[model samples]
Structures are given as C-alpha cells and as structure tokens.
Target chain A: MKARVTVTLKNGVLDPQGKAIEGSLGSLGFEGVEGIRQGKVFDLELADRSEAQAKADIEAMCEQLLANTVIENYSIELL
Target chain B: MKARVTVTLKNGVLDPQGKAIEGSLGSLGFEGVEGIRQGKVFDLELADRSEAQAKADIEAMCEQLLANTVIENYSIELL
Candidate 1:
C-alpha cells in the first residue's frame, strides 16, 4: 500500500521560508503572487496493511513526529 | 483565484530530514513505517487571474524559486 501525508502550518503561523520564496519569485519576473504558504508532503510505502490500520499508524506518526500539532495540521491519504 | 503548488524531492535524492522524522516516529512507538519522503506544498491566492495565466506564473515560480529543478519536481493546481 502507498500513503501520502500532507502537513501544513496552521493559520496565523509565520512562514519565513514561503515569504523568502515569494520574494525570489518576484525577482525572477513572476508577477501577481501575493503570498505563499509552504507545507510538507510525505509519501510512504507500507507492507500489506489495511487502509484503516494505515490511517491509524499515519495519524500516530503525525502526532508523534511528522508534525508539531501545536503549529501544524496534517492529513493522510491512502493510495 | 487560488493556486496550490506541491514540490517533491526527485527519486534517488537523499532526504536526511525525512529519515530524521522516521526515526522520531519509531521512537514514539509508531511501527511498520519503513521510509518517509518529505515534500512541500504551497497555497497562494491570486488577484483575479485566469487559470492559464496563473499556471504560467506558477510554472515560472517553480522553475525560478519554488523548486530546485536539479533535485526537485513541482506541480501547480489552480483552484
């Protein structure tokens, strides 16, 4: 089985990296970009696990390590 | 208009950050996770631009700023 986890900064969190990228884009002549918020995606290969099991495992992973729950939100998709 | 950009490390690229997260997950008692590959997602709000124009602008952003073509791939979706 394959799983994808997307982790994103919560609203009101500052994204310095995204801001930097936006600035770089402006310098490169790309116009009309007002802002950028960057997040993370994790792709995983699982070994014969059921979708429910995988989702549970991934949720645990997110809470434990993949994301800082205080400042980030995560969602998992089984593929 | 709104746009989403997902950036991922190319296959065969080393991801130390992902490895670190996997390790942390294991220590936190999440089992059966073999590997984790991390990527980035960017959400942008555009100022009333056509989809084609936004896609073009985002492509330029990816090439010039959002992704390192040498080691990453990026896809843009207009929403």
Candidate 2:
C-alpha cells in the first residue's frame, strides 16, 4: 500500500520561508502572487497493510514525529 | 484564487533525508514502514486572477524556481 501525508502550517503562524518564496517569485516576474505558504509531503510505501490500518499508522506517525501539532496540521491520503 | 504545487524527487535519485525520516519512524516504534520519500508543497494565494491564468502562472513558477527539473517532478493543483 502507498500513502501520502501532507503537513501544512496552521493559519496565522508566521512563515518566513514562505515569505521568502513569495518574494523570490515576484522578483522572478511571477506577478500578482499575493501569499505563499510552504509545507511538507511524505510519500510512503507499506508492506501489504490494509488501507484502514495504514491510515491509522501514518496518523500516529504524523502525531509523533511528522508534524508539530501546535503550528501545523497534517492530512493523510491512502493511495 | 489559490494554487498548490507539489515537488517530488525523481526515481533512482538517492534520498538521504527520506531515509533518515524512515529510520526515525522505526526508532520511534512505528514499524512496518518499508520505504519513505519526502517532497515539498507550496500553497499560494493569488490576487483575483482567473483560475486558468493562475494555473499557467504557477506552472511557470514551478518550472523556473519551485522545482528542479533535472531530478524532481512537480504537479500543480488549482484550488
């Protein structure tokens, strides 16, 4: 089974890296880009686990190490 | 308007960060994690552009700055 986890910054949290990217985009002539936020994606391959079990396991992984709950939110997708 | 870009490493490319992450998951007792690959996501808010134009512009951004075409693949999402 394959799964994907997307971890994104929570609303209102300051994202300097995102700001930097936004600035760079403007400088590179991609005009009218108002805001940019950066996040992390994890693509995982598991060994014959059921989709439900895989989702549960990856959720636990996100809670423990993959995401900082205070500043980020994570979503899991089974593929 | 909003758009998202996901950038992932191309196959056959060595991924030390992904390996480290996988190792960390195992150490933290999340077993059965066979393989892990890491990627990046960019969330953007645009300034009142049409969805079609937004997609085109972000595509350019991805090709020119957000993604390294040589060893990475990028996908754009319109939202």
Candidate 3:
C-alpha cells in the first residue's frame, strides 16, 4: 500500500523559505503570486495493511518525528 | 482564491533526504516503513481569479521556477 503525509506550517507561523520562494518568483517575473507558504510531503510505501492500521501507524509516525505538532499540521492519505 | 503546487522527484532519482528520513524512522522503532520519498508543497493565496486563469498562471510558475521539470513533476490544485 502507498501512503502520503503532508506536513504544513500552522496558520500564523512564520515561513522564511516560503517568503524566499515568493520573492524569487516575483523577481523571476511570475506575477500575480500574492502569497506563498511551503510545506513538506512524505510519500511512503508500507507493507500491505488495512486502511485503519495504516492510518494508525502513520499518525503515530507523524507524532513521533514526521511533524512538529507545535508548529506544523499533518494529514494522511492512503492509496 | 487559493492554489497548491506539489512537487515530487521523478522515479529513479536519488533522494538522500528521503533515505535519511526512512533510516531515522527505522531507528525510532517504526516498523513496516518500506520506502519513503520526500517532496515539497507550496500553498498560495492568489488575487481572486478564475480557476482557469489561476491554473494557467501556476503552470507557468512551475515551468519557470517552482519545479525542475527535468527531475521533478508538479501538479497544481485550485481552491
């Protein structure tokens, strides 16, 4: 089975990288880019498991290391 | 309006960060994590525009800056 974890900054958190990218985009002449926030994506290949089991495991993973819960939020998708 | 851009490495490309993350997960006692690949996500706030316009603009952004099409694939979502 395949799983994906998306980790993103919580609302109001400062994102310097996102700012940098936004600036770069503006300088590169890509207009209409009002604001940008950057995040991380983890694509995982897990041993075949039930959706419930996979989601449970991934949630644990996110709590342990995949995401900084204090500043970031994560969502899991199973495929 | 809002938009999202997801950039992921092409298959067969070496991803050291993903490898390190996978190793870390193993060391942390998270089992059944077969393979892990890391990618980037960009969330954007665009001036109110039609979905077609937003998608067209973002596609250009990806082509010129957001993604290295040679080794990465990008998908855009409008919200």
Candidate 4:
C-alpha cells in the first residue's frame, strides 16, 4: 500500500519561510503575490496493511513524527 | 486567486532527509515501512491575475526559488 500525508501550518500561524519566498517572488517580478504558506508532503510505501489500519497508523505517524500539532494540521490519503 | 505548488525530489534523487525520517519511524515502532519521500507545498494568494498569468508566474517562482531543478520537479495548480 501507498499513502500520502500532507502537513500544513494552521490558519493564522506565522510562516517566515513562506514570507521569504513571497518576498523573493516580488523581487523576481512576480507582482501581486500577496502571501504564501508552506507545507510538507510525505509519500510512503507500507506492507499490505488494511486501509483502516493504515489510516490509524498514519495518524499516529503524523502525531508522533510528521507534524507538530502545536502549529500544524495533517491529512492523509491511502492508496 | 490562490495557487498551490508542490516540489518533490525527482526519481533516483537521493533524499537523506527522507531516509532519516524513515529510520526514525522504524525506531518509533512503525513496522513494515519500506520507503518514504518528502515534498513541499506552497500555497499562495495573488491579486486579480488571470489563471494563465498565475501559472506562468508560478512556473517562474518554482524555477527560480521554490525548487532546485537540479534535483527536484515541481507542479503548480491555480485556484
């Protein structure tokens, strides 16, 4: 099985890296770019686990390692 | 308008960060995880630009800033 997890900063959280990228975009002539927020994606290959078990495992993965729950939210898709 | 850009290590590209994460996952009792790859997502808000223009601008953004074309591939979606 394969799974994809997306971890994103919660709304209203400050993202300095995204801000820096936005600033660079403006300097590079990308006008009208008001803001940018950055996130992470993790693609994984797992053994033949059931979808339900995979979801539970991935949720635990996110809470334990993939995401900082203090500032980020995560969602997962199993394939 | 809003846009999302995803940058990922190209196939065959060595991803030390991902390997380290996978190692950590095993140590944390995530069994049967064979491999993992990590990517980045950038969400942006733009002024009233046409979707075509936004796409072009974001392509430039990825080429110049968001991705290292030497080892990464990026895709952008406008919303």
Best by lDDT: 3
True contacts kept of 2: 0.97
Tens-digit per-residue lDDT, B20-63, candidate 3: 99999999998889999999999999888788888898998999
Decreasing DockQ order of the candidates: 2, 3, 4, 1
**TM-scores for candidates 1 onward, in order:** 0.92, 0.96, 0.96, 0.95
Candidate 1 on A1-79: residue-level lDDT in tens? 8898989899999999988877877787777778888899998876778888888888877787788999999988988
Clashing pairs in 3: none
lDDT for residue B36 in candidate 4, whole number 0-100: 97
Off by over 4 Å in 4: none
lDDT by candidate, in order shown: 0.85, 0.92, 0.94, 0.92
lDDT of 1 by residue, B1-79 (tens): 7888989999999999988877887788777778888898998877787778778877877887778999999988888
Q: Cα deviation of B73 in candidate 4 (Å)?
A: 0.7
Span of ten consecutive residues with least summed lDDT in model 3 chain A: A25-34
The positional error of residue A68 in candidate 4, measured at the CA in angstroms, is 0.6
- For DockQ, candidate 3 versus 4, the one ahead is 3
lDDT of 1 at A35: 84
Instruction: Write candidate 2's Cα lDDT for A16-79 as tens digits.
Output: 9999999999889888888999999999998887778888889889999999999999999988
